[model samples]
Target: MSRIAIVSDIHSNLEALVAVMRDIEAKRVKKIYCLGDLIGYGPNPNEVIDIARDNFEFVIKGNHDEAVAYKIPKRFKRLAAKAAFWTRREIKPRKRPGYREQRVRWQFVHKMPRSEQLGTWLMAHGCPTSNLEYIHDNETALQVFANEMGGSRICFLGHTHVPGIFTMDGGEVHYMEPQDGKRYAVTAERAIINVGSVGQPRDGDPRACWVLARSDGTFSFRRVKYNVDAVAERIYREKGLHTSLGDRLFVGE
Candidate 1:
């Protein structure tokens, strides 16, 4: 593949997922990787899971995926924990005539790995070591950089629902704001890149986000606009999902 498409935190929004898929197809990108969170906090968890399993070449397990596949952890907040529990029950196999087997989707999430290393990059749901941890701030980024064992030159992660780049030069970490289609060089300096969230974004932007990594060691952040209102309405119509999930889609929080 000339470009490897990377996406993460797709919390079951079909509209956003479709939109991102369309963008990826238009770019003629074949190989794709997912940083999990395939289920929870949105409508159509099964559909999202199907897309991730069928399309993405590599997948990393996120906190929500772990919760749904095994047990919900106490680390999740009230709404997130509720959504994870709801999704666990929602993905149960049922007698739907035209639909694919729900058990396959559950199995897909169950088989996800917490981290995967490819070339010079390490893919993870949150960070390299912990899936529940957040690298949104500089302090956390510093710790993550400190824990680096010199195996991977770059770490691609998603959990904070924010798209940005963190570079470590001479033991000092620096954060850079990411823009759509903006490409950055991956040098010998250690770096961590968040591909952002596909279903739910908390970076004050409602657009679906992803990343494109070229063979030349350059990364481009991409965002696509999707129908948030339609997805939000579907979330409201779906049973067991909280209305706040729908509310947050509009604000991207």
Candidate 2:
């Protein structure tokens, strides 16, 4: 049996990453898949990237990753652009020292692919139409589902930051609510699972994030609480980050 642990949207929060890794290790998962946005909106960007390099089994690129590597368009939501710009700054601080190393690391993140398949799952930060598309609900997932998966039966996505699962077959779609503390069976062989965010979770629940455990033909979702207060404190001390970004961690809204 092969067990895989899936995580996404780490956002450079090292504390959260550590907690998630500890928990994932406890489960003894052999493979770990990251759905992208590995850096952004958090402190310790360089350290987090380094750790991902050492640990993650597979990594996919997200819009934020693209923004840091390549020049993202100014037309792509001004607020998002601002966040991505700020994230780049957080990753690569100048004058003090280590700026060059950070720049190189950012380049490494950009090198990540937009989509990839591992085992039976296709991983992408968002819908296949665009790496930035958010898959938050059934209607949206259905619209992008058919086109995104193409030949693959299962597509795992991030970008929504909300943990959810949606399956579409024969033009009919079904929504699976976030699992409750246990691994939910994959049930259908062909399905799409959104692994959710690792650092930033906006699913109304204030836990670190969600992970999918896949073995054979069954998959389960598990939530593990990390040091939210520690991450919040780091964000607060980190200069130039929008205060609201740090504030949202308390409620996980």
Candidate 3:
């Protein structure tokens, strides 16, 4: 197996996506997997989806993606709901020159699966069973290991927008924050790895977060800096998106 890159929660920030893709390319990673949320809460939904469709090998259906593509009811807050609605309006096919292309991209998002199994690893936008679930604590991690792993030794997730590693061995579970460029050996009986967010990082660092997994049973977290102010300004200029969406980029909240 070749080394692969895992990214999630892009949230349509074109600058962050471009910067992360450049970093991935520089690392010589050939395969990239996306955990979804390709749109919503950012200014460039269509552009982000274009890049994702062109690059990622597979993309799991996230809550935001689901809401936007299907117009399904989700537990989004006021701002997120507003953004999702706006994204729907933005990506919805229209009677324009690019109508065919737009419909194709919309269908691409609409057809994304909820979960994918890669050899011994399971990939999901959140937990295996639900894209809306958040595996944020040891208890939730243990629950996933017991009930949701579906016979995989490792599960890769990206809904919390915070990078961390959870390992279960000898009937004990341990959680650790992943550091940039530090490779963590995948020796646990079961593990859940959160690759964090690519466009809207909430880990307080503000840089885009992703993970590089090697064929040698180890993975390292990577973060790349981009022009946050530019994206924030774009968000502010967009009438449908709220200002807080852009403001959060500066603080990584």
The candidate scoring highest on TM-score is: 3
Candidate 3: stretches off by over 4 Å: 72-74
lDDT of 3: 0.92
Candidate 3 residue lDDT tens string, 1-253: 5789999999999999999999999989989999888888999999998998899998899999999987656567889999998999999999998999899888988999999998999999989999999999999999999888888999999989999999999878999998999989988889999999999999999999999999888899999999999999999998999999999999898
Report the C-alpha lDDT of model 1 over 1-253, residue by residue, as the tens digit.
5888999999989999999999999988869999878878988887787788789886799998899889888877888888888898888666775335787876788889888889778899888888888898888988888885257888899999999999889988889998788778976478899999999999888899999888877879898999999989988986677898999888888
- Residue-level lDDT of model 2, residues 77-140, one tens digit each, is 6655666777777665466677787766766786798888665567788886678677787788
Error of 3 at 141 (Å): 0.6
Q: Which model, 2 or 3, shows the larger TM-score?
A: 3
Candidate 2 vs candidate 3, lDDT winner? 3
Residue 169 of model 3, lDDT score: 97
Candidate 2 similarity to native, TM-score = 0.90
The whole-model lDDT of each prediction reads: 0.87, 0.76, 0.92
Q: Estimate each model's TM-score.
A: 0.95, 0.90, 0.98
